[model samples]
Structure formats: C-alpha cells, structure tokens
Target: MGLGLGFELLKTEGAARRGRLTTAHGAVETPAFMPVGTVGTVKGMLPGSVRETGAQILLGNTYHLMLRPTAERVAQFGGLHRFMNWNGPILTDSGGFQVMSLSDLRTLDEDGVTFKSHLDGRRHRLTPERSMRIQHLLDSNVTMCLDECTPFPATHEVAEKSMRLSMRWARRSRDAFVERPGYGLFGIVQGGVYPDLRAESVEALTGIGFDGYAVGGLAVGEGQQMMFDVLDFTTPLMPADRPRYLMGVGRPSDLIGAVRRGIDMFDCVMPTRSGRTGQAFVRRGVLNMRNARHAHDTRPLDEECRCPACRDYTRGYLHHLFRAGEMLGPMLLTWHNLTYYQDLMAELRRAIEEGCFERRAAELEAGLALGDLPAVPDPLAGPVAAPPVPEESSSVPVDL
Candidate 1:
C-alpha cells in the first residue's frame, strides 16, 4: 500500500464535520465545493480568478479530456494543471457517468464499457484499468474508481446487479491505481436509492479500501429528500477518518443539507451551467437576470457579494449584456456563482468548527426558503412616461 493521503478531522457537530484534506497540489478545508472544471478548464473564468473565488480544488471530467485532446497530449504538456493554468488540486471522475449519459451507443459488461464518443463518432473502451491510467496521465490528485452510476427508478434487482458490477470494477480500479505519495484513489458507492444496496456498496468499497469514499448515483433526478434519506444511513456507515464526497450534487440548499449530513466534499455543474443561462445563485435564492424587471434597476445582483459582478456592476448592466448576447455576461456570472459557492463552504466549515452547525444550517435553510427578492421595477417606465395615442381609421375623412 502507498503512503495514504492525509485527512485530518478537526471537529464534528452532530453529523457535520470540519476537516482538512492534504493533496499533492494543496490543502482543502472540508465541506469544500469543487467547481466543475471538465475538459481541464472551468467553463468561463481564468485560473487565477477561480482561486480568487476561494476554490482550492476543481473536478475535471475524465471522459471529455481523454477523448478530445487525449490524456497523452495533456501529459506531454506537463499535466492538466499546467495545461489549464490551474495550480490547485484536481479530482477526476472515472468517465463511467458521462459514458452512460452522453454517448449514443454504449454496452456495459463485466469487463468494462464500450461506447461511441459523443464528440466525434470514434469508438472507445473504458475499463477500470484504462480509467486509472487516464487519471494518472492527467496527474490528478484524487482519482475516482470507474463504476456504473446506477440509474434512478431502477428496480431493486436492477440496482443490485449494477451495484455488484461497480463493486467488481472497484477492486480492479484499486489494483490498477499506481501508488504514489500525496496521490490517492477514491472508491464510489453506487446503489441507486435503496438503503440496503447502498449499505452493501459501502461494505464492498470499505472492504477493498480507498483513500476517500464518494456516494455516487445521486442527484440523478431523485429529489433532495430522498437523497438526504440515503445520506442519513449511508454517511454514518462511511469510514469516519476518510473524506466523504457526494458526486454531482445540487443547488445551494442541497450543498448545505449534504454538509449537515457529514459530506466533506462536493462537485456540481449547477453553478457554472446556471451562470451561462443568466441565473445567479444568491443568498436568498436564484435570480434570473434575463428578466425585463432588471432592465432599468441599478442595484447589484447581491449587495453582500464581493464578486466583481456584484461589486462593480448593476443588475441593469448584466441584463443588458445577456440581452445583447455578450460573452462577458456568462464570464461575469460564472465567476460570481463560483465565489458564492466557495463562500458558502467557508461558512459551513466555520459553523462546524464553532460547534454551531445546526444553527447555521437552520439559518441557511431559512434564507433559501425566502426565495428571490421582489424585482426592482423598471426605472425608465415611470408614471411620467408618454401615454399611448389612439389611431384614426385610414378611411376616415380627416383634415390635415
């Protein structure tokens, strides 16, 4: 066995935990939010900007990089960090999720998966060994085991079969991963929404051993309540010393709820993806900046936000940019959304450390429940605006 990765659990309040994770690139405080940086780059922001947002790590997609530039090319360029100009820690997914979601044709068997690329019509095969190799080439600090993301609504029988296949893959992945100091592999637990299956998955992964553990196959359309119910039983069973990650999870409320349930790390595309669509995640709730109500409003997206978009510009300007199809619109919103997520994580860590996680969680839930503030009325369409003129019929006899 390799020298295991360092994970120091500092404090715990109820199920909430405050800890630190030491990686090859850097140390990440627990209850961390890893912005999705698929394809070696976080969608619209610069590396430095991402750091400024308080993000210590990013999650890269193994499926995308392996197909596009190819892992060999990324390795030639001194790995993903140098290539993407991000010097922080990176956790790479095992490509199984994307293979099932994005690919047109896919066949999964005990050996592995064979699929056609969504990017081009190219054929590709991904086994646990190949998945391990791809992440290794990318020089990822945290590598996830290749496992099927059990589809939601699957029968108990189907879920069991999928979970068993993933368990088999987990063993192969563990064996295939090359041991190196400061680098670690994570095992994924994949058991749809069934508590028994989830428990079995946890037993299997823990038996094989991993530096960290991730609860996969969630946020796949199962509502938050069900996801939390899974966590209720699942997280308690995870090894307390190792970091616990919830993959592809959720809105701000989802993050807070998961953290309250003892999840130490999370990765999601919601922030960046929503940002691109003119949505801003604020303390109160989500704001749709594309609305006409913001057309003449001069207030910032969130008065408390320190992000450049909120610090310097008005909602009016953001609305105009989106309306005008400006690229900067997405860039600014993405930066702000990422900053918001990191800030939330920081707050959670602080709460847990202070032994007031429950209070903080209640506060977060209350704030989210408030929803978006009432939109500012259009300033230009005041009562002094011009009145509508009645039009006379063209056939009317009128004197000029």
Candidate 2:
C-alpha cells in the first residue's frame, strides 16, 4: 500500500537535480540539507531558530529516541513535531547504525541485531519491523529502513556478505512499513566502496521498491575522493523518478560534490558539532573562534551571512564568549553554521534552476579554496601566542 512520497523533480543540471518533497507536515526544496536533530533537538539551537536558518526538515535518530524518553513517550505528546516544537517534516533513521556503532555488546543476526543500550546497558532488540513501528510512533514523515551500515576497508567477501544481509533486511523493512499518505519509507544501499556490490545493492533496493533510495555505507572511512568515486558510478543507476539521498554526509564541499552528482537529500551533524567546538563555517571556509588571533579582531565571522552572530556580533566578542566558556557561544555559532548550510543549499538549488550549477559551484568552491581571511598583523608584535590546535579529525565519532 506504499505510495511515492510526493517528490516532484522540477529541473536538472548535468547530474544535479532541483526538486521538492511534499510531506504531511510541509514541503522541502530538493538538494535540501537536513540538520541532524538527534534526541529530538538540534543541540544548542531552538526550533524557531532552525526554521529561521531555512531548514524545512530535521533528521532524528531512532536509537537515541528509543533509549531516552522513548518513542511511546513522544507519541503521547502528539509525535515529534509537537513534542519538539518543530512543525516541519521529520526524518528518523532505523537505529541500525547506532546499534552497530554506539552500543557496547552488539550481536547481529538475520532477524535483527540485539544489543545493550549505550546509555543504560539495558538489553534491547531491533528488528526491521520494530524499527518501522518506532518511526511510526514518532510520526516520522520520512522513515529509513533498518539496514546494516557496513564498515569500511572490509574485504570483498566481507562487504558482500554484509550488503546481502542488509538487502534481506530491506525486504523485511519494506514489508513491515505501514503505508500512510504523505509519509514514506526509504531503503539504504550498502556496499562499502565496491562498485559491483553497490550495483547489486541498488538493484536489490529498487527491486523491493521504496519512496526513495539512500546511498549509505559511505562517509564511514572512505576519503572524499573515494566517496565521489562511488557516487560517480553508482548514482547513474538509481531510479531517477524517486528522490535519492546520501545518508550521514558531510561537509559543505561534500554536499556540493554530492549535489553535483545528483543526490537530492542529505543529513549530517558536522555543522552543529563544529559550532560547539569553536569552529565557524564561513564563506572562506572554517574559521577557528578559539584562536588568540581573534581576541582583538572585531570583524564578523562572515560579512555575507545574515545570521545574528554575524549581523549582531564581532569576532572579538565571539572569541571572548568561547574563552569564557559561555553557553551562548555555542548557541550563537550553531545558529550561524546552520544558516550557512541552508544558504549554500538555497544557492545550489537556484543554480540548478538557472542552469548555471557548474559556474556557481565553481565560484562557491573557489571561495573556500581562498581559505580563511589572512590574519590581521598584531598591533605590538609582542611575545608569540600558543600554536592553534588542528581541527579535530573526523575519524573519531562524535555525538550529533
């Protein structure tokens, strides 16, 4: 009884697509970026502010919600929209990734995975049917299937074995999902970095069918070039009639590359997470607010950004807040980063519509290539300051 999730492909440029997704809650422009709102809230941000940043949808984690307040608790409060004060569309993952990555003692099998909760160590079981039911309880507008996210660097034998297991789970998830108007299920394609396995995964998901298809098992350990390589070959085979998503991806450049490769939807915690750690995503790339050089600087993070942090504050002031360990620092920066991401998406959509995606993308990327603005010369040129710590490596998993 499942139906298409009301996706309308309005335009295309090369491999890029411009479209819209209509859900029970609202409509999201394609090439859209969904900010991760794990545990029912986007950390350091209010729903009103997130909306102001131009986000039409938020991605929730089924594993986190199922553990904490629980899906039943959310349903009691009239679903995630009402519960979180976000009236827009919501997408929830199947809890498989978290079970595999976060949980301590995880056991995988055909029926599902059994593991202890990362938060409490309480035993729990997650099958395809249970995952579907949890998303239903949360009233998710877009529900992801319970697929095993295969780890990177595995042998072909290992990758194929994992992918095949996920394909079998996809069928179970498809059968278990209850079709509701304006709400739909998406199947994840998992094959590590293998092209043949990816082709097989695409075939498996499309054959069983879904409202949309998501390329998963990427951004795990594969570098950016490898990720692009996977998309280059794999995206062409995906059903264009349905929306195509790239799950758990990525930086601004990554988003740009993916959009250029024809992915319509994406979700990631990079922006918000960086915001908390004193990193600001600006037009000229990431600027560190924790640096001492900014202590006396008075310029805004990005002159082009309209976020309050930029419009109303200064780099010196932002630096002061972070140095003082004020909570407002993270909030203001999170708002700014989200606003930047939305602005990027809007520009990409506009570019695709205007048939100038290549030029626009080139310009945007070249801006980042220019790197952060040159440091202003120190007034006194006094004793040298501490060397800035390198931005944390992405390999280490951080909570969304």
Candidate 3:
C-alpha cells in the first residue's frame, strides 16, 4: 500500500462527528456533502462555480462516464478533475447501482453484472476488478467497491443472497485496488433492510478491509424511518476511525438524520436535480419557484442565502426565467441549492464540534417542518430566527 489517506476525528456529539478527510487532491471537511458530477460535470454549473458553493468534493458516475466518454479517454485527458476542470477531490461510484437501476437485460452472477447499456443496445460486463480499474483510470481520489445494491422490499432469502455476493466481490475489489497515497477504495455494505444481514455484511467488509465504508442499499424506495433504523444499527458496527459514507442519500432532512447517526459523508442528486426542475431547498424547506404566487414577488428565494441567485435575483425574476425556459434558471438554482446543502453540512460540523449537535439538529428540523415560508412577509423583515436551540437537558433525538 502507498501512503494511506488520513482521517482525523476532531469531535463528536452523541453519534454526530466533526472530522476531516485528506485525499490526494485536497482535504474535505466532515460531515460533507459531495455534489454529483455525473458524466464529468455538475449539470448546469461550472467547476469554479461549484467550488464557490463551498463544495470540497464532487462525485462522478462510473456507469455514465465509462459508457459515454469512456474512462480510458478521460485518462488520456489526465483524469476527471482536469477533464472537468474541477480541482477538488473526486469520488467515483463503482457503477453497480446504475447498472442495476438504469440498464436493461441485466444478469447478475458470481463474476459480475452483465447488462445492455441504457444509452444504446451495446452490452458490457462489469466485475469488481474492472470497476476498480475504471475508477483508477479516471483518477478518482476515492473509489467504491463494486457491490450489488439490493432492491427494497426484498425477502430475507433474496437479500441474503445479494449481500453475500457483494461481500465476495468486495474482497476481490480490495485485492484488485491499486494502493496509492491519498487515494482509497471504499467497500459498500449491502443487506437490504435486515439488521442481521446488515451486521453480517459489515463484519465481512471489515475482515476484508478497505480505506472507507459506505452504507449502500438504502434510499432506494425505503422510507426515511426505515433508512434511519438501518443506520442506527449499521453505523456503529463500521470502523469508527474511518469515514462512513451513505451512498445515493437523500433530502436535506436525510443528511441531518444520517450525520446524527455517525455518518461522515453523503452524495445525492436531490439538490441539483430539483434545481433543474425549478425547485429550491431553503432552510425552511423546499420552494417551488414556478408557483403563480411568486409571479410578482420581489423577495429573494431565501434571504439568508448568499448565492448569486438569492443575492442578485428575485423570486419573480426566477419564475420568469423558468417559465421562459431559460438555461440560466437551472444554473442559478443549482448553485443556490448546492450552497444550501454545503452550508447545512458546515453547520452540522460546527454543532458537533460545539457539543450541541442535539440542540442544533432540533432547530434545523423545526425549521424544515415549518415548510416554505408564507407567500408574504414584511418587506423589511430579516430571515426568520431559527427556533431556539434546545437546552441540553430538554434536547431529544430528532425524529425523522
């Protein structure tokens, strides 16, 4: 193994953690939210703009990149960060989830998954070794092991079979990974929603060992409660000294819940995807900018947000841009939403460091539960004060 990546746990409040992850490219603060850059881009925003949103890391999709530009071609251009013009740390998924979810005529066996591309009728096979190689070619700072993402509502027998297969593949991935300083491979924990299966999977991964561990097989139609339930039992079993990432997770509330459960990292498409659809995530909840009520509203989307969209544009203007089908609408909203998520992660880290995570989490949940702000407010009013942070004695675990 080359120089191993480092993780420093600075503080913890209950299960919440404040840590730092040092990668080959740079260091990422935890709890952190990595913006998804599927196909080597973060949709409508520039790489520099993404960094301006306070994102220290970005996620690339192996399935998409391998199929389109091809990982080898990306390597010719000197890896994803340079190819995409983003200098931050990049983590690449092993393509297992997308293979199962997006491909057709899929077949899973001991070797790996074989499927026809969703983009075309071309067929391909992805094994653990091949997935690791692809990530390496793309120069990922963090590479994920290829594992089956067990579908929701699976029977115990089915889930067990799937998880066992993933564990076997994980071992192969670990052996295949090329150890390098500041670059690490992560194993995915599968088992659907069963605690015993989850525990078994964790044990298997730990035995094989990787640089990091990811909680997979959740957020795939399983409700938030069940997801949280899984995290409750699963996270503690993971190596406490390493980073714990929850893959393809979630709404803003989901991030908070997972962080409180000891997860240090998360990546999701909700913020950017929603932004493209005229949705904005704010401290108080989601705002649909397409609503008629905003046609004449001059207020910023969220007065507290410092993103250009909020600082320089009004709700009415955003509504007009969306209605007119302007590309700038998605660009601005994506930037704003990404900023909001990063800001939330920063606040969570601060609260954990301060030993007030429980109190801070309560205030966040209460704010989100209030839903989007009312259609009208006093023009001169400031952003609403977050509900008081509960006293330590009065604080309780936030219910998702």
Q: Kindly provide the TM-score of model 3 when superposed on the true structure, using C-alpha atoms.
A: 0.93
In candidate 1, position 325 carries an lDDT of: 98
Predicted structure 1: lDDT = 0.92
| TM of each candidate vs. truth | 0.95, 0.94, 0.93
Per-model tally of clashing residue pairs: 0, 0, 0
Instruction: Name the runs in model 1 displaced over 4 angstroms.
Output: 384-400
Q: Candidate 2's residue-wise lDDT over 213-278, tens digit each?
A: 999999998899999999999999999888999999999999999999999999999999999999
Candidate 2 ranges with C-alpha deviation above 4 Å: 1-4, 378-400
The 10-residue segment with the lowest total lDDT in model 2: 391-400
lDDT of 2: 0.93
Error of 3 at 205 (Å): 0.5
lDDT (CA) per prediction: 0.92, 0.93, 0.92
lDDT of 1 by residue, 1-400 (tens): 5545899999999889999999888899999999999998899998999999999999999999999899999999999999999988999999999998853589888899999988777889999999999999999999999999888889999999999999999999999999888899999998888999999999999999999999999998889999999999999999999999999988999999999899999999999999999999998988998988888889898888999999999999999999999999999999999999999999999998888989988998898789877876665664553344457634544332
Can you write out model 3's per-residue Cα lDDT over 1-400, one digit (the tens) per residue?
3436789989988889899999989999999999999999999998889999999999999999999999999999999989999988999999999998853468888999898888887998899999999999999999999998899899999999999999999999989999999999998999999999999999999888788899999998989999999999999999998899999988999999999999999999999999999999998999998988787788999999999999999998999999999999998999999999999999999898888999999999999999876686445555665566568666554432
In model 1, the Cα lDDT at residue 306 comes to 91
Q: Model 3 clash tally? A: 0
